[model samples]
Target: MKRDLGRGGIVVHPYRGYGSRQEVFVMGRVFRQAALGRAIPHHGVLRDVADVVRRIARHGVAGVRVEASLGANRTTATTDRDGFFDIHLPLQTPLPQGLSWHQAELQVSQGDDRMHCHAEVYIPPPETDLLVISDIDDTVMYTGVADRLRMLYRLFVQKAHQRTAFPGVAALYRALHVGADGEARRPILYVSRGPWSIYEMLEAFFQLNCIPVGPILFLREWGLSWRRPWPRRAEDHKHDLITRMLTMMEDLPCVLIGDSGQHDPEVYTRIVKEHPGRVKAIYIRRVDRRPDRERAIERLREEIAHSDCELVLAADSAAMAAHAHAKGLIAQHDLVEVHQACVDEG
Candidate 1:
């Protein structure tokens, strides 16, 4: 569920979190009059530019105290220098059966001012078979990440709805989330190399396109400064996140989805090699046309051939869906919907 800003200037913006039955981890930020409100439908390039500026200019309130409670379990933490608070609350009692989504009450205070909000937590049921982890940039949406200038233009000037998703992606993700039986409620987690400033834009993009909203792990603020000019390597960031997810959910196998652009192939290949049998499949979208890149990915595919995971480089979402159906990751009827979505989106 989405939370609204409180009356005070202070706001607690909580991202979706996932955890096991024994413990729940939730994270959010405390900001002063800098809440990125819901992305409403709007028009004009100037408005889009203004929206991006507003997002970038927002500042966090550092050192604020944050308290989180899930039922009787409670924990407290102070915000980091970036005003981000991460809380790990141990569960005295296991979560109720059959409930996939749970809410945790969050309150942030600095001096006499305080603000309250709810954080959503996702815990996959025991019956879930596969955990889906996907990349956002070129995998799900059309952000020309390989071309820096074009990517920046699209990122800074496009509204949520104006930004387009690849054909049939929504249906494919939906099918993956529901599983073959159409009864399992599997979690679909997304990871991005983008910074936290664009969080609201991505959230609105998921809601607008009907994609399942999961915990989106994003990078921290990056800019040209005296302290640090360059951002961390994208490969390192994504690799760390995937490994953390695998460690957190040790029982469930994972389906890795990414694009040919950048280091997804290398990063995912490393994950497959390091965690053998844990990754069921690796789906790479063919976003780049370079032959050398294709050959490199092919070598990676062959390298992982000994493992149980299959590396699939697909030209379109329909191809991925077909492979998933054959592997029983998605239902047979869902394939039809994916094909129709391709045609409709085209």
Candidate 2:
């Protein structure tokens, strides 16, 4: 079920078979606070409105409550009439070594049909020294939302309702989170520009596709409608977020993975510039063939010219594996590594 946790969030219970296995979506105030009196009308579409209402009805009056076992330890509000709640947890919470894993429990009380859901929040261990910043649209999946033409067509006419993943991106994502040994570990962070509406969709897509779970930070919509186009100055917001995250983990090195479709090159380029010494490398997927996009492409090249961050463009997951092996990102023996490491550990 999906619900708006008022401050600008869309909480998503992304998977089934909970307990020690699943994770829930928890958004931040950057979006929630901004969305306060600025939500666009639902267009009063009966189907869409009904869907939201049904989801809310599933939660009932008790609604949902989230308790993050990290940082200062905070909880969230109950579901509103619009089916929304907001919980603002600090990015870093000082927990004991064994308690590094954050957990959220949802108790839905709608009369006799009550439900209790819980998922482990994959908080990075204190010893974690690796960071993974990723691109959403194509690098993660085959959404192909970066292209203005397809985006226009889908946003206007087709609506391209279903979201799908690229062939092996999920497996690669799993490897990145779990390393050689299989354990419920951390050191992974997913950064994207996808708006609030699809928060649950993105989480569901990743879980269904076998991608490992991680903290997903996305854009705030900033009062824009769902059909609003990507803004011209949007990359700066990502750049700022990256900088803050990097600064928090300044002691560790980060690996940035993105697609050649949008502002990733530019955002990451600025990140490398601001914290050149902290960036380990960068990997970009080749998705578009426009020469005009060369300006953004050049930005990555410019960063590579002066820093230790290696930037490579892959045609697909296979190409990414080959290139990663060649560059020593992972061992050659693990080249065939498929699925998330947690499965192996289980």
Candidate 3:
């Protein structure tokens, strides 16, 4: 996808997509840039605020037609009121072997204006051992999500490179992506309660921090509009997305990762109960040290103890990595790297 934005033209922002061998799911937004606007500065506090405002103030092009094609398979979709289009294209035949990433051509047109971009679709190789789903906010980075004011302040004032990821997170995730054999090539998907407005920033953060990127799924914008007076519950949104992912890749069991700052523990526990043999393990970062929260999570841990899945409440990435290594989810050498990364980051 193109990084630089040009003025006064139609632009399609295609996100990374994921799918099984038989079908692909992709989504993107279309925007018509204004012809007259000064180039925003890219430094200092005021510039960061301006950039945040610009990203949230985007006006989507509604009713525009979007066409996506992969090989001989083709599909068309129209943008919704929010200028977002989702395409689910079924492959004419299974994708070729030994190739995990495939490029799909995306074209958006309305009247005389047309724009084109290429989206990458990922399909886990047959050697994959399991799927990994993780929450983004407190689990992967230091977002201060438990404190709304601090989170909002940092969200608007900090650039992507300025954001801080937890120590050893990159190494742990990389180890999970390449499972115990060191060649498993597992797919790692991230989910967030954040709106789509910050998609670019999060993408840049992943690149800057060396986090393995897969399909990043986020909720829609939230406000006090008449159509949506209140945002959807975080647990429900995350639960639905995880369910969809598990259904899409039914052959593989998965490992779930999240933080205890919010509803991750509860949501993941519900998933474990609902999908009995499908969950290999659950890792919850101990972001909230409240006694009540700890006791609640302990009860949940015991509830799922009878099943194969183990709920581990870890204090940091190193703790999680150690458990994962013992469970044969990651390689032994990867655990050493994660421990060293923790020391180096500290």
Which candidate leads the pack in lDDT? 3
**Ranking of predictions according to TM-score:** 3, 1, 2
Question: Considering every candidate listed, which one attains the maximal TM-score?
Answer: 3
User: Which 10 successive residues of model 3 have the least lDDT summed?
Assistant: 1-10
The digit string of per-residue lDDT tens for model 2 on 223-326 reads 33347534444757878777766665546777888888877777777777878578776778888878777556865687568777766766667666666556
- Arrange candidates, best lDDT first: 3, 1, 2
RMSD of 2: 8.8
Residue-pair clashes per candidate? 0, 9, 0
Pairs of residues at least 3 apart in sequence or in different chains that clash in candidate 1: none
Q: Against the correct fold, how does model 2 do in TM-score?
A: 0.66
Which ranges in model 1 have alpha carbons more than 4 Å from their true place?
Answer: 1-9, 33-49, 223-231
Q: Give the winner by lDDT: 1 or 3.
A: 3
Q: lDDT by residue for model 1 over 1-346, one digit each (tens)?
A: 2233322255568888788778878888876554343463355655465567655555678899988898788989898877788898889977778898999998878899777789889988888888999999999999997776777667666768789999999999999999999987888889877777677788999999999888887754554344653455555878888898888888689999999988989999999888878999999999998999999999999998889899999999999999999999999999999989999997
C-alpha root-mean-square deviation, each candidate: 3.3, 8.8, 2.2
Winner on TM-score (1 vs 3): 3
Which candidate, 1 or 2, would have the higher lDDT against the true structure?
1
TM-score of 1: 0.91
